[model samples]
Target: MFGPEGPSLRELAVQALSSVEHGYDLLAPKFDRTPFRTSGRVLDAVARALAPLGPFDDGLDLCCGTGAGVRVLAGLCRRAAVGVDFSAGMLDVARHQVRAADGPAIGWVRGDARALPFTAAFDLVVSFGAFGHFLPRELPGLFARVHSVLRPGGRFAFPLPAPAPASDPLFWTLLGFDAVMRVRNALWWPRFVMYYRTFRLGTVSAELARAGFTTELRALPEFGRRADGSPRVRLVVATKPTTQQGS
Candidate 1:
């Protein structure tokens, strides 16, 4: 649907009608060629933001679609970097596409994000452009899963673009796209979940706090600022506290 090398319109329709996991499995081979893959520019910006903060031992890319986030992790982590995703096809492609050039050892695991297999094992966790697959109600459990897998003082980071203003055509474009998705899910079985506007940062920040993260936002100047002087993109830097507190 995106380009000549990308999936066709019919192929995208078939994917959208399938379950989210299965749809990604179908799209895996062409995923990087499609615009659906996170941009290298964003990845480089995130890597720059994170590089100064770490001499991290191990890192994980949650919902690591084709291991794009793993590239950033490889550069920053000293020991190892792991990419975890539910789709075997995606992981297969990731295993082939990502390599450590004198960087950390890289590996891939197949798993669901809501129930990650590890516990307090990673020094850093990062995700790129994978959050919309999760519904808003799932935030608490999802953030808790991230919190549980990270060691004390570890950071969970991802870039979040500011919501488009009402005057912007892209704003309404996303709004209309989400409306169509709502109708699609209502009538379909094995619903595909991807919504651009549903993951609100204010709600997400509060949920991260509830999940025991001390959350903060850092402006990604690479994406530049909005006319209102706020950043067009901000990195959500949610840190697990160094000392444990009573649950």
Candidate 2:
């Protein structure tokens, strides 16, 4: 359901076939217009939730696409903020989109998420809507890399919506989409790994714990409850142990 400003059908086809980095690079210019970019509502809500935990000195936005998540970092962080992504095209748009005074000074870097280039240089690290680019097996390296970049007592936070059950139509929609993705990747080269269903809560929570984090799931009340009364949105706040060794 991309809006009129989102990528065209031909554009989507090209991105789907390319490697994740190249795909994002091709889509970056129009990314903010797509459903892929983090929403302003979600970002503001996360900023509010994060405010209590911070007064952060420096921040990093991991896999920062178009820098929407960096704006949240800017709210809590005082000094400098950085955004890293493999896609240079994404960084270019992020550079132009999110600039404000009384906020953290934003800088962009081109880098892979699985092998971050910095060490213990940040008080906060955040990502939005980019986890799907990583396969389940890749979470260990990716999370470890995020952990490495964070200073003692620093956090790596992101939002995770509660999943729809099998009975729900949305669940089937997502399942079908993921199945299609699997088929496409099986038949193609430069596979795009983005899929919503693969990032389930229990598995992810375990991975976060394995990556040396004390994790918490904070319910987002603003998004309201599901039919079963579970919060529709949640913030996964995973903190690197304050005593973690610095590089």
Best by TM-score: 1
What are the per-model numbers of colliding residue pairs? 0, 0
- State the local distance difference test value for candidate 2: 0.89
The per-model lDDT (C-alpha) reads 0.93, 0.89
For residues 6-47, write the lDDT of model 1, one tens digit per residue.
998898889999999999999999898888899999999999
User: How do the residues 13-39 of candidate 2 rate in per-residue lDDT, one tens digit apiece?
Assistant: 999999888998999999888887788
Poorest 10 consecutive residues by lDDT, candidate 2: 238-247
Candidate that would win on lDDT: 1
Per-candidate TM-scores read 0.97, 0.95
Give the Cα-based TM-score of candidate 1 against the true structure: 0.97
Model 2 off-target regions past 4 Å? 244-247
